[model samples]
Target chain A: MRRNRVLAAVAAGLLLTGALTACSATGEGGPVTVKLLQFQEARADVVKDLIPEFEKAMAKKGRPVKVDLVTDILTDDQFRTKITQQFYSGTAPDVVDMGGSNVTGMAGAGYLLKLDTYLRTWDGWDEYYPSVKKGARQRDGSYYSVPHEASVQSLFYRKDVLQRLGIDTAQPRTWNELIARLKKVRAKTGEAPLVIPAGTAWGGGSWTEGLLPIVAGTGSTLYDEKSGKWKLRSKGLSATFDLYADLVEADLLPVRDLHNPNPWEPTKYEKFPQGTLPVAAQGSWGWKYDWGPEGAAPIKNSREKIGTWDYPALVPGTEPAPISGGGFGYSVNADAAHPDAAVELAKWLSSGKALARQLTAVGAVSPRAGLADTAPYSNEPSLLQAEGKLKSSIQPPLGDGEDRVSQAVQSATAKILAGEADGSQAADAFAEEAEQLLGSTRVAE
Target chain B: MTTVKNPAARPTRRRRERAALPLLLGPSVLLIAVFVIAPAAYGVYLGLTNTQLTGFAARDPQFVGLENFRNLLGSADFLESLGRTGEFVLWSAIIGQTVLGMLAALLLRQKWLRGKGLFGALMLLPMVVPEVVASLTWASVLSSESDGTFNRLLGLFGSGAAAPLQEYPMASVILINVWRGIAFAMIMFQAALEDVPDELIEASRMDGASALQVFRHITLPLIRGPVFLYLLLTTITTVGVFGLVYFLTQGGPGQDTEITSIYIFQSAFKYSQIGLGSAASVILLILLTILGMTYARLAKVEV
Candidate 1:
């Protein structure tokens, strides 16, 4: 009986130990495990290849951390939902890959670890473009995330199609000139010459991908940083809407295609390659991820066939600047057990060959200054060209009330696309809605 | 007389039994309280607050009692979605699925019908297909491309790319949902019809009653229990349908097909207005409850 009791006790103790071990993320005497969560399929393979290298580098830096990365792919939508829930539930991943838009809100909600102290000591901090570093800074002058790759918005046009139509391939000096060019294309071919993603279906794209570059080129900011107010109605905003109205009224834009569930499919993938759409405002990703040999719809000799142009100014006197935003960036969760290691890993992912490989795979320009002279970045001419556009690029201040502003843009542009409202009317309605959401004090005309 | 010596013992035993009642029912009551009641209560609380999925409001939400609901009621989009949801449920669930399923079931019950097993299998195919797969199949069929299944069929008659989804989003969604939901109703009605006595129909037929009269007077009344049950189930399920409409048209083409559920999803996940979405959900819950109660009362079914 004594022997049997002892055996039962031993079994029970062993079972309890196993349960506790299973529950713990890092076991006793085991290396601290840092979890990395991400959702970019274009960079998934590259990221996976870089993880072992990251682990080795960290070991050399005196942190013997075991990186726990889940290879299960998630769509962007899934990532947003999962990350939000995880943060609220206090089970957030140690390090995360997210869009630039999410940084401000996440930082404000206290979900992200403030990275200013770490960044100050890091050598690569000076290598990142000034615009990128400034965009990542919160209103409180704290950094919460580091931009991994930069997606500069540019005018993606078909070179062969433009040449055939006898249209100048040079960048138009102003919005009016660009509009005239679009009209010429439509008059010659009778096909919608441009696609600027609009409608509520396009979601945030209506703001960032479609409107921001034009707004920036107009020399008026949507959300003024100095006044800390959303420019609900301004000359620049009206000009942006007027341009949209012109495209819609003249039938120079694919209005129907913009309302499709996935507008990018019909506009960028199918129509552009088929020559039905000649010009579109797209991120630098259009070079490879949207039109490359390995893209969903590859155009033969895409690099040779496609050309890039900066968004033009509203008036001739001012120089035009393209828009740039963080394509994908890394952040350390505030609740991480291995925050130091996580921060190191994030820094490792942002600079050197790792960032180059990731950016090249996704057709994005590196925010880091010298990466353009390196092997992988130099091999790709698209990246080299896009690098030059980065310095002249403007990243609109996005943090507080960004979601509401995006919605307002989508709602206004959607009305423009449907022909329900003209530019002035839509601007009025947009102003009203933004004022209601952000309050009168926070909105400006 | 025989139990007179221990009469107090019987009362004690009865008291013990009464005390043990809670112990026996504790697990079930606790489960329901945790799973159903707690979440619902939290939803109600969340509805009264200005809780957002992101930004400062996410961490420290302020109470804005009835504001979310007031905004929802005032918004044209929400009101339109309610109307569209009503039309969708009426056409797809109440009328389309019920009638077609009954017809299919009646035909399969016919002795003269050949290949009854094959026909039933074919009808069951949509039900067996995964929701996402079925949605993809329908998407392909109704694609705007000239080579799409429906477009190709239209092309045979010299029609251009109809783009039926963009032109007729509600009708297309209703049609697809009707197709997907028919099998469940058919199965239910088939089982109910099996319990329906053939002798009564034969008697009625001999008494100069036509097939239609017999069905109207006998079969329908006999299967009234299952009919109401199916209606209650189908109505609730149809109102909650998300994947079919979402994957196909995501409440698009300018909110033409934005049903109540889709609106709630957009308000919550898309717009990140958790409070507004929760308020909408609370209203939806109350409406569904009233609907279920009305159905139960009309059917005179036991609770």
Candidate 2:
């Protein structure tokens, strides 16, 4: 009896394993399913809108390919963490949606399928702006990700609030001038003047949106492409830290609320719309997706009330050192079973109508120069304005461990803003931590 | 003599019993080997490699012996995380849960207490609520908003809304964990308290012993085993805590609350340094093992 039971149990286990294996294998039936994993919250709706179009395109092409999109609504840091976990377990989706620095890092490390060969014959690849395409290409000039949306970031302010308070709303040419303006706005309104994403929960936004402009304004930045080194302790980096410290010391930045899980929500979506916060660094999408009529606040008078300005230089005389990045880039997994189908799906995702839908939904500045003439692109004034600035904006080169660098910078910036560490001390600590996090050989200076 | 003669002949009763036992347990043994042992073994192997989430190394990982372990030992973040984790366990499990749970159990044991069933249910309520809900509920209560429950309570005393989570992150995490975990200790202590003979307490009272004296001398000694058991369980569970703290703080206001679990998670998944993460996990495994062994020795039982 016991022997019989053991035999039955063994058979059951075998059957279960076999069933699971069969289910996991690339199916041999009707339509090939391409899994898309994405963390862009705004595109969740856009993807839903595009599924029918994708099906129709496939049917027209007679490929019978099915798109299965898996959207993770977690914040960027959280979703990327989960994506890495999936990569380790060999269960990652066929296509992934990532941003400039992160997608570049993933591509550099060979997680993404090289798309140069695939794109050489594709017609629309050349229409992308050179800087935009730079993000999708590796060190060896192999194209991995297909760059779609170009992100244009700058300071967003309430024009009506500034005018009401008798303050000048002109774009400041330098960091000192911006501070002077903020001091005036604060003294006049007696409210929090600027909101820099500060806490660790804000992730790289703390460094990228708030600190990088200051660094660039000083004529140096984090990633030095020539040596492939992270310049952790530079004059520019220290200056950036000082700028953040100044904000905290002046009580200009909302440090407390920035520690919340959705730090941007209160500062950008709620306070910015209500005119409580005068200025915040925002992408073009910040208006439409986060604070416009389609956003959480839905402030009706947003178009008239809001204004955008270029992030200023560190000194008064130099031009505004603007920074733009790949807002969303799509890539295929190297390990995906249906790589060809995944490639087809990626192409479809970046094509005219589907890409237009995404660009409209996200209100992102389009990288494809031709999209500027598209109907949907023409409709968004904010996007059009941002696209005009993309030519002059700086697209910083990314390194291998950009995520860790971002986290390390974010942690140090957070400590400074929270008053846990002084500026010089925080910079020193950040340099050390980042060097360790990125591994020493990755850092040159 | 029959057992010795049964080598090639019919099996003896003891032999049959042993053979039947192995056959009966074979399936479960196989399941455990496949599920638990295989992953554990794989984890150890991963710890020895230079495998990352991306790169050529990810495709073909090369073993680096003890490099990851050395790196972990030398890492300030990992060491700091270890220290913070120790503090969290000490406060949340050893002191907070055990002491508070014991007090609740003592209160509930009073014969004249009203609505014992309702009180019992209330005590068990936090244990039943989902972890995400519990953490979020605490977040709302402790927020910096002036209308938040904690701040509102302090308003009558002329105090402003001070976000305890932002100001006293570690304390807030410890308090919430205690709130969530006291149920286990309470229920266990209640059972232990019930097992304490009432006749001895009554006799002690008749001898002019006060309630406190009886609890300290007789009541406490009887429940010593349960106390150790509770500490042991809470220690292990508290050390492995992830989800609640992850949601509440994500290991920051600035790494102030970065416990070992969070650190390991960040190293492996967030940094995509899977080998380093796996090494840290192995260290964590050993640390927990040592803790478990120490607890077993203290409890004088196989734990």
Candidate 3:
């Protein structure tokens, strides 16, 4: 009886230990794994450098989160497929980066967590601009994303080339002055004076960003909020189209020869940095990535020679026009295991201090309002110029009709450039398409 | 001996054997049903609906019923891609595999060739190279820049710049596919040739027939079945060519070399139009099915 009792006790102890181990393995307070997906390949290295810092910070807070960064070098569509598959399998990443248009569709699918409750109490929420906050919120006025960075479209000119043509580098405040300078530069250089990439989809969108500010400066809304429709046929838009056509017809802009499959390659950053192209219309981020310390060293001492200026108004007396605010942000997955941890990480990443550090490293504008003016980047002359210009920058209309309007503008510009359609025809076609896309109620005057 | 089993007992034994047979084959049958048939059926179902990946939870997918098919029919891009895929199948599988394979088989049959076994193995080097490696190698060889092997060779011949793919996108990819595929075709044909009866060829030669005449009359007829088999196999393989096109041009320089498989991939993954992409895939499948049936009937007669 004594020997049997001892044996029974040993068996019970083993069983208890096995049960305890199993229970402990699946319990809370254990390291929770999170996956992060991003688009930019260059940002992979930056994330790698920052993950240890994040982990260390979390350790101090007694939160044990193990983030598994899965850097996918895929196109926008490919990333969507992966995200969709994960959702189907019930194994989606805790956080993801999505384009502005994609967020609505994803949120509608219930794949994103509503962050309204968190946003209301978050201490650092006030750092973001009102426009940024408004843009990041869903239709129900619930916030879902944290804005990381913002970009503005600007004219990147080769100072040496402009100086060679006896054009002033001190900012041209009006469209007529800019055009006069472009003609002089063309006459002296015998090269395409203004570079625009029409073949690339993103490149095609550049026209809308470049022209929106000019139209807005002329006191015309690109899209009327009351009507919820785009105004391609408006007098302001027609003038913008005419100016674009005139530029192309006069050989001021190379639209015909520049219609190569990869138009952005020969004229933009690739050639601009190598001194093959004189001027390019590009985003502020492109300026940083293509010209900053992390980028290819500018043509020996060309850093001082390179200059940036805002899009000038159509007329002299119009509001100083600029296209503002285009960039990516982070949002937590609705099905994430650790929602709190994900939100914490997102908020930390979007904080003014963190954004400032990122800007110092990458030379991009922070989404936070005052960071551009007060951060370490404020001292840089070109950035300071961009900051000064940001006040006049006009935000692109946000709604279902935005993409259609933008595409119409691009297609119309392409037609005018190709000489298949004149400015008037292009403008008329654009108006019809925009009206059809935006519905009659939203049509701008 | 005189006593015989009852009919009911015999039938019961037969029934037991039938049940056991299923038990024996159950695992394999279940695997095929789960992995192959189920997914294929699911794909067909998905092809009929207008399902967007992002809006899956809130939005009920409308049964668009043939809208995807109609869209594909109207799309110039889709038609162009199908034509490109057909051209690829012709050049790569028909001309490259069949003709080159026959030539290799004939060469290997020569008694003058030393180390026949070793030579036979050497011929399969291209087949053994990984697809990714092969694609990268071909890409480097056909690179548009001066650094590429083909351009460098052209330079040696007194040319400045030569872009084979850019100039002839379809032909360039076909050439790469053919070069990579010839080894398998050669091996299959060589095996088929070895199986041809030596006596028949000897008899034809003895009747004062020339070497070419004997080969034409006897060897060709004898090898027809295998040749037909090879053609069918190669066609199926070539029709689904994606990796080469993807690593090479990505269906561009203005969609000059886009194929059906590449189109399906773009629609499904890149464009996020899963339903439309699935429909495109079904179209490709129907095309391949027709070809397969035709080949099967032709192969039966040839054999």
Listed for each candidate, the true contacts retained, as a fraction, are 0.52, 0.48, 0.36
Docking verdict class for candidate 3: acceptable
lDDT of 3 by residue, A291-340 (tens): 77565343545457677777766744564455664566777898887898
Best candidate according to DockQ: 1
Question: Which order, best to worst by DockQ?
Answer: 1, 2, 3
Model 1: share of true interface contacts reproduced: 0.52
What DockQ does every candidate get?
0.47, 0.36, 0.24
Model 2, runs deviating above 4 Å: A1-31, A315-318, B1-38, B55-57, B146-162
Global fold similarity of model 1 (TM-score): 0.90
Clashes of 1: 0
Better of 2 and 3 by TM-score: 2
Question: How much lDDT does each candidate structure score?
Answer: 0.84, 0.81, 0.69
- lDDT per residue for candidate 2 within B1-303, as digits (tens), equals 354554645457778888899799999999999999899899999999887875433566779899889888997778989999999999998999888899889989998999989988998999999999998898889877788899999998999778898789999999999999898899999999999998999999999999999999999988887788888889889999998898788887778899999988887887787888899999998998898888878877665
Candidate 2 chain A weakest ten by summed lDDT: A314-323
- Candidate 2 on A241-329: residue-level lDDT in tens? 88888888887888777876678877887788889888988777776777767776677777888888887876435577567745778
* lDDT, residue A113, candidate 1: 94
Pitting candidate 1 against candidate 2, the one with the higher lDDT is 1
Question: In model 2, how well does chain A match by TM-score?
Answer: 0.90
| lDDT comparison, 1 vs 3, better candidate | 1
